[model samples]
Target: MTAPFDDLRDESQQLDSLVAALTPEQWAAPTPAPRWTVAHQIAHLAWTDRAALLAMGDPEAFAAEVAKALAAPESFVDDGADEGAAQEPAALLARWRDGREELQEALRAAAASKAKFPWYGPPMSAASMATGRLMETWAHGEDVAEALGVERPPTGRLRHVARIGVRARDFAFAAHGLPAPDAEFRVELVGPGGELWAYGSEGAGQRVTGPALDFCLLVTQRAHRDDLAVRADGPDADRWLDIAQAFAGPPGRGRPPKGPRPGPAA
Candidate 1:
């Protein structure tokens, strides 16, 4: 069986390859993320990758860093991105590549351990940590791809992202200080290869069904629920779509419906 880290590595390599060919002007292009350029997206990834490495190598040091971040949760992420964005494009790319390699090595080395790594939210096992990394990589990569006017091909790998989105339904509500729904919702996504990936009970009253790519975009806040092909069958599921955040953080104000989605590349 392939470990989540294997998928993480593949996602990282795909994003790296995509960015490596970008021109300097393209790197500076504004992404879908408000106030964040392509550089900021990559820089943020690099910063988190370094933090993940620290968490793996030295828990005490990582805890200290986490404490500092907790002191200013709102600004910590942006501040780190600003620092990373100051680097020249080459330097930034190198830093991200090195950090990613280090993180992968650490995860592999710790595969046998049952230790939980502390994060902004709950601590995570190595497998969950890797899945989170994969989700982040794909989410941010969408921003960069959009800035370049490149259409990212949807893949079966999006199963990881959809799973996270389903799992985060309650987290999304809780992050906004709202009470979580009492019942779980079934999530059914059609993979790029036409496979059905279903989660939760088939008979659940609340359910979300959609194309995998649209679900991913919605969960990542790259596209508004209104713009996606997804459908929520119940009130709770509908509310979840209004604020479905896969990444750990405050509740995100999802993208507003900005005209119809563009057609696929001819």
Candidate 2:
């Protein structure tokens, strides 16, 4: 648990370092996400951190305030409803950095030993939030990389991504209004650490396996499943792949990568 938060702090710092290295032109580069520049991705991550901070401090109030703000008709015009709508890029970056630091401070100050917050689905403990933060940082980091056409160095935080992939397996299946397969799937990551992860079993459900980084990328929709070495076993594996969702929201069909390809195995 401590490792998850520590990893979150580390990832945030890394993201800052990565952003700082970008030239002005690079900052404005277009990403795979239509209408979003690299700066926009960073701003979004900052915004999400702010949301997580509010949720940690006061879940009920946070939910209420967010609902009130987003309920406005004019909210959509803010371009993804960015809180720092009128700010310059530098100002937005500063706000994002400051907000991330504030979130870290708040997370540290709270009683980490016994705290749980309502997430999009599960009641996430402090540890889960830390892992969630890691997942987000890495995912958004990918957005920056895709924009710049540079590869990022995958690290231990990938385990967080892998964990999210497992959790999203059920969501992936249910996205199409289909019953999730009732079986257990053993997932193995052929990493330097030889990581062993699993979800439902073969008789219980489908199994997903491959390099940890690919698993994360597949679930995040950052990389097409076919481009990666991920392997799914069991009868239902292929079915699960079509609808996996990592982010919280109503079931969404992410745009296929630039071309047609096979999705995760059911």
Best by TM-score: 1
Candidate 1 lDDT tens digits, 82-147: 888778899999999999998888888777889899887778878778888999999999988898
> After superposing candidate 1, which stretches have Cα over 4 Å from the reference?
261-266
lDDT of each: 0.87, 0.72
- Give one digit per residue, the lDDT tens place, for model 2 in 16-87: 877786777877788776667787788778777877887887889777755654575344323542455345
Error of 1 at 117 (Å): 0.6
Q: How many backbone overlaps does candidate 1 show?
A: 0
| lDDT for 4 (candidate 2) | 77
Q: Give residue 119's error in model 2 in angstroms.
A: 2.7
- lDDT for 117 (candidate 2): 80
lDDT of 2 at 239: 61
The count of residue-pair clashes in candidate 2 stands at 19
Query: What TM-score do all the candidates reach, one by one?
Result: 0.94, 0.84
